[model samples]
Target: MMISAATPFTLLGQNLLLLPQKAIFWEQQKALIIADVHFGKVGHFRKAGIAVPRDMEQSDLATLSDLISEYRPEKLLFLGDLFHSDMNNDWDWFILWRSQFPSLQIILIRGNHDIIADSHYQKLNIELYDELLIGPFLMLHHPLPDIQLQHASGYVFCGHIHPGVSLSGRGRQSITLPCFAFSSKQAVLPSFGKFTGKVAIRSRLTDKIFAVLKDKVIAID
Candidate 1:
């Protein structure tokens, strides 16, 4: 296992640590970056009379808690899709989780799946934004095209598509793994929620791709 659970990469003169947990850490900002968490997804499925594991949300929350304890980030920046859909019993878990980290500022960039009323987030002391320009990065729910991104005021960090890259072996085996894709103008983060699906991405020669493994992240050469 890759015990460190971190891979360092520098962007726009600032340092970023890509983590196996499908999150990122902005060293200068002292913030934990997560995208597409879909917190209540399992509950949504179960609500439809489908059998889904009840521990999924708890597991994801536990992982987030662990990261918080280890990094001690002052703020939590969520790119988008923080919750799956609607207000469900699973929301109570989030409320309890929020209570534990009363001092840690949580910020969410509004996304399509975030249909919950603003009052709900406000009640938890969470800040909501359509888009945000923080330091050298512009945070958004949907990633912009390269043309638009080039003219953006800052390097972009966004997530909407759950990105993945296909890997092939000498034995004709192929597998798709979630990845962190970095282009000259933007960085598309992988979905942090394990219950989400991944879409394979075709990257350019100059782009950097970091494939996430079970316990570590590896850069694709």
Candidate 2:
């Protein structure tokens, strides 16, 4: 008999389920939220004669498969940059992935890098949105400015920054790794892409941050 993998914790009045990979599942919303997958990026790099690893794309998809099998989320929300560049052979792999999870709704909040033809997404049946409202949250690919905070209406969930924290020691230094950074008005997620880079972020005194570590997510005060 096979045992089901249980979802993870609840945070900030939301059910934050941490899968084995870096993806997060929101139980109440029945959505799996991931960021900056940059699928087909390796192909893009190689097309330009850059020596990036070839297996990165396949490995990325495999991780998605694992998460899907484990949580069975009704929808998969890509925060941004689903594909790195224009469509390529690697895109068919994504099309095949869409077929594998036919019943699973795929929504791409169009990020800056999503320059593929609209017809292609239409063929794949993936919904495109500049921003979305689900419950009390406004889902977007990029974060809003501080000036907009005064007029903000709801909690914002966004990606694109690929937020990480720096953790250093006497002789060893390793970043706190990718994280789900939360504040009063917004929450920023780590990039879902394996080949993407991370940026260190500074949290405010009133902010609540969750640093995603190797095994679990740790709360930082």
Candidate 3:
């Protein structure tokens, strides 16, 4: 769970870092921030007749646990989609998880996929917000559309794209890997959920991009 300091990058006016495990380690608040965990998604698919490994939810939880224990963060922020669906047996796993780290402050920004009742999250004492302002940044579950970009108070951090970057070689080999994409007004985080799919995002020449590989995070020139 112990990780070295994240690689810092400046977006808009705030300082941020890209972590190894597809998460962001915010320096100012000493918080580990991640987006779109989509827990229990595998189960949701499997129950609908799609084949999926049942152990995925546990693995995802383990990853979060490792990050928390390593960083010993005072706060943890989930950008959205912490839960993939309505209350199900898989939700019990999440409830149990909340007990393990009793002192870690948890916050969830509700995403479109978050349809569970408020009572469930309240039981775990996880604070819920449609969006929030932390320092100079505006955190939300979904990225602002073009029309809203000009009106934003500060730089925005959001998810929902599950963004990735595509790499190609001479041998017809191509790979799309998750990435952090920064624009003038906002930054889009790669999905934190291991089971989620990614779409390669096209970036402008001035855009700052970082790709998350298995062992480390690499900048995209």
Candidate 2, residues 104-160, lDDT tens digits: the string is 899999999999987899888899998888887788888988778557667888989
List model 3 lDDT by residue over 1-221, tens digit each: 45644677865555677887889878679888899999878878888999888888899899889888777789999999999977677888988988999998899999999999988898899999999998878889898986898999878889999999999989999999899998888889999999999999889987789988887888988
Candidate 2 regions off by >4 Å? 1-12, 172-176
lDDT of each: 0.94, 0.82, 0.87
Please, what are the lDDT tens digits per residue for candidate 1 over residues 1-221?
Answer: 12457999998889999999999999999999999999999998999999989998999998899999889899999999999878999999999999999999999999999999999999999999999999989999899997797689888899999999999999999999999999988899999998999999999998999999998999998
Q: Residue-pair clashes per candidate, as listed?
A: 0, 0, 1
For each candidate, give its TM-score against the true structure: 0.97, 0.91, 0.94
Clashes of 1: 0
Scored by lDDT, model 2 comes in at 0.82
For candidate 1, give the lDDT of residue 9: 95
lDDT-superior candidate, 1 or 3: 1
